[model samples]
Target: MGKKCNAPPECVPDYSKDEAYLKTVIPTRIALFESIKGQQLPHRQSISGNPIKYSSFTIPLNYSGMIILRNGSVKDGKKWISTPLDIAKGISKDWGENALISKVNGVLWDMLRPLEGDCEPKLFKFDSDEGRDTFWHSSAHILGQALEIEYGCKLCIGPCTTRGEGFYYDAFYGDLGLNEDHFKQIASGAAKAVGEKQPFDRIEVTRGQALEMFSENKFKIEIINELPDDKTITVYRCGPLVDLCRGPHIPNTSFVKAFACLKASSAYWRGNRERESLQRVYGISYPDQKSLKDYIARLEEAKKYDHRELGKTQELFFFHPLSPGSCVFLPHGARIYNKLVEFIRNQYWKRGYQEIEKQEFGLKPMNCPGHCLIFDHRVRSYRELPLRLADFGVLHRNEASGALSGLTRVRRFQQDDAHIFCREAQIKDEVKNALEFISSTYEIFGFTFDLKLSMRPDKYLGDLETWEKAEADLTEALNEFKKPWEINEGDGAFHGPKIDISVSDALNRKFQCGTLQLDFQLPSRFNLAYSAEDEAKKERPVMIHRAILGSVERMLAILLEHYKGKWPFWLSPRQAIVCPVSEKSEPYALQVKDQIHEAGFYVDVDTSDRKIQKKIREAQLAQYNYILVVGEKETEAGTVSVRVRDTRDLRDESIEGLLKFFRDEVAAFR
Candidate 1:
C-alpha cells in the first residue's frame, strides 16, 4: 500500500436486532445539501452558478478570454463564464458528448468547472485515468443516493477502485443487516437518479458552515472535525446527496447509461472494528451498456484469479478474525516468501546496489531511523559515502481493517527496505540505477508497470530549494531511462518527492509495490555527515529511501492472481512431484523423489492407490510445475517421464539429467 498507494480503499450488516431498529432515516441529509446549495447558489442562476467567492479572478463587463487547448489551438472563452465543457463542445460534438474530465494547467479540472482566466485545458475521455476516476466517483454518489433512498442508511466514504473498474460506498445501517436480496432495489434507485439528470455542483464553506451543514449526520460531522479549522472544505451535491469530497466528478448523472450493484458486505466505520459497524455495497457504472457487459465478463474472469480465493485453494495462506489484516502463511507460502527474500538479498549483494555517496540512516522502527543511528555512531570517511544498508526485519502498521483486502494492505508485513547515502552530485546516477533494478526485477516476474514522478505534497518538511533539486534529479533519472512516465501532482511523501512504481498484473490491475524516494529531511534530522576531500570539511550526505518488493506478502498476493495460482518454476513451492504408475514402480518413484529432494528442491512422491492418469491429473490440478511419472520402463533405464503443467507434453530423461534441468530452471529465475 505504501509504494504506489491504493486507489479507493471497504463491511456487513448487523442484527436480524429483530427489526434491527429499522427506523426510517429522515431525508435530513438531502435537505441539508439543498439548504447549503440554496445559500451557496445565486438567485435566478442556472446549473453552472456564477461564483461569488471561489474565483480569484475579477471579470470585467462581458469579459472575454481564450482557452489554450492541448493541441496549441485557442478558442474564444469568457473568464468566470465559459467552462471546459464549452470549449470541448466547440472542439467537436464527439469531444463534447464524451468528455469525462478536464485538466487545467495540470490540475484535474471538472468539465463543468468554469475557467477562471486564460488558461490551457486538456479534455479527457473515459480512456484516460482521470476521466475514468471522475466517472466512477460520480457513480458512487449515485449509489449513495440509492442506498439512502432505499434503506435510509448513513453514507460514508465512496470512491473508485484502484484500477477504475467500478466503485463502492461504505455506510452504517444500525442493526439493519443487508444481503444480495437488496441489490435489485438498490439498482432501481440508482437508475432513477440517472434518469433525473441531476447536475453535480460544487461549493466551498468555512469549518463552522460545513459542521452546521452536516450536523444531522454524525458520520459526516466526524469527518468534518478531522479537518483543520482554517481549511476551506468543498462539498459536491448530486441530486439529494451532498457528499464530503474533494472532487472533479462527472458533469451530471445522465452520463451513466448503465449501472449495477455488484455485491454487499459488512464493514466497520472508518475500517475500525471498535467503531460503529456498517454496510458496504459495491457497484459499477458505464456510459454504455456494452462496456458494462464487457466489464461483467472481466469480473467473472478476475474472480477465478482472485488471490484470496487462490491462496485458500492452493493452501498457500489464510486470514482469520483473530489476526485481521495479517496473513498466516502456510509452509508452502513460507517457501515462496523465503525464496523471494533470499533472491533479492543475493541480487543487491552481487550487483552492489548502492548510492553514489555514503552515510548511515536513523531508525524509528523503519530502516532509515536505525541506519541513521549506525552512521552517526562514529566519524565516517568520504570513501564510504554510498553506504547501502538493507533490512529484512518485519514492519507493522495499523492499517484500516475494511481497507485490508488480502495481502495488498496488511497490518504485518516485510519490505525489501534499504537506504543509500550519497553526495548531492551523485543523486541522478543512484536514482537511475534503482529504476533499472526495478525494471529487471519486474521483468523476472513477467510484470508490466507504470512509472510516475510524485511531486512534493501540500505539506512538506524541507527547504523549497532542496525539494526542487531532489525532484529535478529524479526527473532527470526518469528521462535518462527513456521510458514513458507521468506526474502525480501533490502525491509525494511529506518529506520529499518520489519515483512511484505501480506493477500491473495479468488482469491489468495495478499494485503499488515499489518506489524510490529521495529524502533530505531525515538526513538533516540525524545530522549525518562524512569527511570530504578537504581535510577539515564535513559534508552532509543525502539519503535515498527505497523498497522494491514493498511487502513480500502483498507481492505474493499479486503474483498469485497474476499467474492464477500456477507459480513459475523458480518460485513454485511444489516444484515437482513423482507419481508411481503402479505398485511395481512405487519404490523407484520414491527413490527418484528422495533424490530430487536431496538436490534442494521441493518434491513429493504420489504413493496413493489412484491410477496413472488420475495421479497425473491430480498433480497438474495441484499446480506442481513438473510432474514425473515412473513405471517398469523408466525403472529399467534409471530415467523418469516428465510432463509439464498445463501442457502435458511428455519427454523421457535420465534422473541425473532431469535434476540438472530443474537446477537450471530454478537458477534462471524464469
Candidate 2:
C-alpha cells in the first residue's frame, strides 16, 4: 500500500529494503503515528461555501544571514539560510558533520532546526557536556523507536543520565514480556533506522492536534493533558516513530553509529506503586564501535563485581522484599561496617572533634538538626572558635522503590557525618583541614580522587556576599592543594557552597563519596550563636557539614566493586583462616585461631571433614587474606605455615614471629 502525504519530504520516513532484507515482513505499530504525520487535523475546515486557501511557505531566494563563530568571527552572505547546518557549512565545512548541537542566544537548538533570527551561536562537540547529553538523549529516542516498532509498546519516558549511567526508556508492553533474548532484535531494528539516515524533523502543533496525533496511546494523552496551556507543544519525527518532546536533537539518526540494549526491568508508572507498571529498558550508544566495545567490556567487568551478587557469594549483605531498601548485614558485614565507623570516629577525636550521641525521638534523614541543638544548648565562645561535633547516626530516607538498587541507593544508611561550628575567620582553615582529611583518609584505601567546588545556585538562601565569601574560601583551599579541580557552577545546595570529592576506583569508574559544605544560612536558621571576641555581643557561627564517607552502605558497595571482593587485610572481615591437616592438629588450630582473634584480627577455625587443600580453597573463595595450615610437626615446633590468598607461600615461622609480622602489616594500613 502506498502512503500519500503533503508534508515536507524531511518530515517522512526514508526506508529502503536491500536484497538481504527479511523475506517475511513483521508488521509494526506505526500506523497510529503515520495517520496524522502528513495531514492536517480535523480542525482545518472551510466555514464558508468557497474553498479556503492557506499561505504557501517557501525559503526566500536571497535570504541574507549572519553567523557568529566562537572565535569572534562572523560569516555573512546573501544565500538561502534556515538550519544551523547551513550556518555551520557557510562558516566552515569541517564543522558541518560532527557538530552535535548549537546554543543560539543561550538556548539549546537542534542543528537541523531553522534559526529564528541572527543570534549568538555556540557549537559543541562530544567533548562538551552539553553535546554528550544531547547525543545520549537522542540515542534514547532511537531505542524508544525500536521498542515501539518491534513490540507495539506504549512508551512512557526516555532520558539520558550522567555519571556513567547511560540511558533508559520506560514503556508499557501489555502481556508482551521482554528479556535479554529480545535485545538482539531490538538492537537490529534500531541499527536499521540509523542506517536509513532519517532526519529528526521538529514540528510545533496545537495542543488539540498533539492530543489527536497520540490519541491511541493513553499515556501520551495523560502527559499532553497535564501540560500547561501556555507551554509550547513540539514533536520530533525520525524514521517510523514520532514522539512528543522539546528536543535539541542531533541532525539525523545517522549520528548514532554504535548501539546496544543492556537490559530490561520492571518500574511503576511515574514511580508510583498505585499506578500501572512499565518495563524499563536500558541501553547505551557511542560515537563509534570501538567506544562501544570498551563500554561493553567495562560492563562485563562491572557485573562480575556487582555488590548484590558478590554480597551473596561473600556473605556480606542481603536484601528482602519485606524491607525493600534496608540491607540485612550479616555478622561479617556488620563487623566491616562497624570498623569503618570506628575509623572515622578515631579521626574525630584526633582532629579536635567531640562525639555527639544520637537522640531517641529526633532521628531523621540527617543528623544535622540534632547537631544544631547541641550547638544551641551551650553558649560557645570565639575562643572555642571551631567546635566540631561528630556523629554516626543511622538515617532513613523514603527512596522510591523503582529507584532502589543495591547499597548505592538504599533507604537506611549511616554516615561518617559531622558538623563544625566556626567563625567567619576560620572558614578557610576548616575547609582546608577537611580537604586534607579526605586526602589522607582516601590514601589509606589507595583511592585517587577528583575535587570540585559547587557555587551558589540561582535560588540560594543566603546574602550574595556571604555566598561569595564561602565560595572564595573553598576556591583558595582547592588552589593551595595544587591539584586539578572543577567548578560546578550553580550546583550548590540552597543553603551553602560545597566541595564534592569523586573517587576513581581500580576500573577507572568514579563515585562521589565525600562532601564538605560551608553553610552560612543554616546557622542563622537554627539561631546558633557564639560570644564575639569583643565580649560585648553575640554572632551566628558558620556551620560546616562534612561527610568523608557520605553513606557507609554506598561506600561499602563501591569498595566491594572496586576491589572485586578482595579487601585489604586491615579491613577484611575474615582476615585469616586456621585449617588443620588432620583431627590430631585440631587442638593446635584452635589455639592458633584464639591467638589471632585475641590480637584483634578476625580469624576462624575450619574443622570440616574436608581435606586441608579443599579447606584452603574454600577460604580463598571467601576472600580470606591469609590461610594458616597446621599439622603435627608445626604444632610441636610451635610454628605455622601461612599461605596468602593468591597462592603465594610464606616460610613457616614461630607463633611469636608470626604475631609480630601480622601486627606490623595491619599497622601499615592505618
Candidate 3:
C-alpha cells in the first residue's frame, strides 16, 4: 500500500463548512423573525422602548394652496392644501395606488412626503426610467427585509442599478449556504410583507439614537459612524423590519405587486476583496404579473442569444482562470476581429485620416498619449491644423474578477480609436464630420442609433470660456444633423463635453458604444501647438477623441448575439463550405473550392465520409453563410447547387456567379 493514503477530515470531498453552518442557524433566524413580527414595530417606539422624535410640518390645516400640474396648468384653478399623495389621488381615482413615485418642483418626492406651499407636481408611472428606479429600489428594501427575516443577515447597501439594468442588495450572512433553494423562502417572506400593504413610514433619528438602536449589528454601526456631520440620518420602517436609508420609497409594499429573486453571489465588504466577503442578492419587480411574465420570456430569449454560450458553440473565444477578464480568440474569431479592423481602416483612408505607428513597449491604455506625441513630432503650419491620427492599439484594464463577463466586460481589448487636433475655429466642422462618420458606420452595420450632447460634469478641467465654446460648438454641430436629439445634462467626461451615441440592438437593448469628446486639456498638457499666420506665435490645439466601434472584442460579441451566430456574408468568419454528394464528386468540390479561394474568399471542402446531406446539415449548424453541393451532373455541367444558412435553396448557380455575389457583399462593407 502507498503509505495508506490517509488524510484529515477537511480533505473529504463532500465537506462544506458553509452548508453545515447554515443548517444550524436557520431555525434561530426564523425564530428571530417570528419574534419580531409577533410584536408590532410601531413607528413611534424604538427597540429600547424610547419614543422616536419626528419634525412637525408648519403648514396650517385651514390654509388652501395652489397645485400646479406638469402641463403648466393648475387643477381646478386653485386646489386645497394637501399632501402630494392626496393631490395625485385627486388627479385620477387610482393614481395614488398605482403611481410608483412623484416629483415636486422637479425633485423626486415620496408619495407620503408632505408638499409645502404652492407646488408643481408630477407623478411618474412604472414605464418611465425614474418610475422604474423607484419601484425597483423599493423592491430592494423589501429584499433586505426578507433576508434579515430568513437568515438573520446583517444588511449593507441596497440600491437601484444605474442605466435601468435592475436592483440588488448586499448583506452579510455568516457562513450560510445561500443558493437558489432559499430564493423561494425569501420570496415567500417578501410576498407576505407585500400582501400586508405596510406603509414605508419614515422617521428622522439622531446619531446616538440610531447607534443605540442598531448596536448589535456592526455593519450599521460602521455606516452610521462614517456619515458626514451635515448628512441627515433617517430610518424607514416596513412591517416588522427597519432599515437605515435615505429614501423616497413608494407609498406601500403593495406597489411592488410582482417580485422574484434572481440569483445570489459572493462579494467582499464594500467591494474590497481583502475584507470579509458578503452575499449580494439580485432581483426584479413589476407592477403586474403579465409584465413580469413578458420580461421572463425575454430573459429566456436572451439566454439563448448569450454570447458566452454562443462563443463556445461557435468556437469564437474562451476565458481561463490564469488570465481572468481576458479572452483568447480562436482562429475563426480572429478572422472576424481582423475584418472589422480592416473595414474601419478603409474608412480612415477615405475620411482623410492617416494611420500612425504605435509604441513598442510600455503601451498606454488609450492611443491619446501616443497620438499627441506624433502630433508634436514635427508640425508648425496653420494648413496642418486639423491633423487626424488613427490607431487600433491593444489596451488592458485591471477589472475586478466579479465584474468580468465574456466579451462584453473584458480586461484586454482594442478600440477603433483616433484623435483629431485642430484649431478652435474649426471645432464645429470637425464635430460635424465626426458625427457623420459615426452615423455612416452605424448605418453600415444596420444599427439605429440616437445621439445626445453630454454637458459639462461637476468636476472638469480647463477654463470656463473654452468649456462654454466647446459645448456651443457641439450643440451647433448636432443641429446640422437635421434629426431630433436630446441633451444628457452634466454627464460628460472630466476633460470636456462630448456627444454620445447609443445604438439599439436587434433585441431592442441599448448599448452606448460610440462617443466623440472635445478635449482642451490633453494638448495643453502635452505642450502641443501650431504656428499662426505670423509664423511666430504658438497656439494650443483642441483635441477631439472619437471611437465608433469602441472595443473590437465587445463589438464582435454584440454582433455574435445580434445575429444569433448567423453572420452575414461580409462578416462571417467561415463564408462558404463545399460539400460533395459522393466520393466521385470530391474532385469537383475541390475545384469549386479553389475557385472561391482564388477570388479571395474563405472556402473549404468537406472530405468526411458522411453523406452530402449530413455535411450540409453540419455546415448549417456551424453557421456558414453559404453551403455549396456538387454532384456528378453538376460536376459535368460546371455548376454547384447553393443553399443558404437557413435551409433556403438556390437550386444551381455557376461558380463565377456565386463568387461575384459574395465579392459584392464584402465590397459593400469595404
User: Evaluated with TM-score, which candidate comes out highest?
Assistant: 1
Name the regions of candidate 3 deviating beyond 4 angstroms.
1-73, 76-98, 102-106, 115-123, 200-247, 379-382, 450-453, 462-472, 479-487, 532-537
Candidate 3 residue pairs in backbone clash: none
lDDT comparing candidate 2 with the true structure:
0.79
Query: Against the hidden reference, what TM-scores do the models get?
Result: 0.85, 0.78, 0.81
lDDT (Cα, tens digit) per residue for candidate 1, span 506-528: 77778888989888888789998
- How far off is residue 101 in model 1, in Å? 0.9
Candidate 2's residue-wise lDDT over 1-670, tens digit each? 1222345645433222121111112122234344554453332222212322111111111112123333223343211135567556654566676778877665688987755554556666665556777888899999988987777667889888557456889987655557999999999989988999988877677888787777656788889999988888988888767888888798888988999998898988778887776898899888889988998999889889998999998888899999899999999998889878888887887899999777657548998888898888888889987989988878999999878999999998888889999988888889889898999989988899888788888678978988888898888988887767766677899999999888988877878889999888778888889889787899999999999988999999888888899998878898989999999999999999999889888999999989988998898999888899999989999889899998767679888888888888777873
Instruction: Please estimate how well model 1 matches the true structure, expressed as its whole-model Cα lDDT.
Output: 0.81
Q: 2 or 3, which is superior by TM-score?
A: 3
Query: TM-score for model 2?
Result: 0.78
Counted clashes in each candidate structure: 22, 0, 0
Candidate 3 weakest ten by summed lDDT: 54-63
Error of 3 at 179 (Å): 1.1
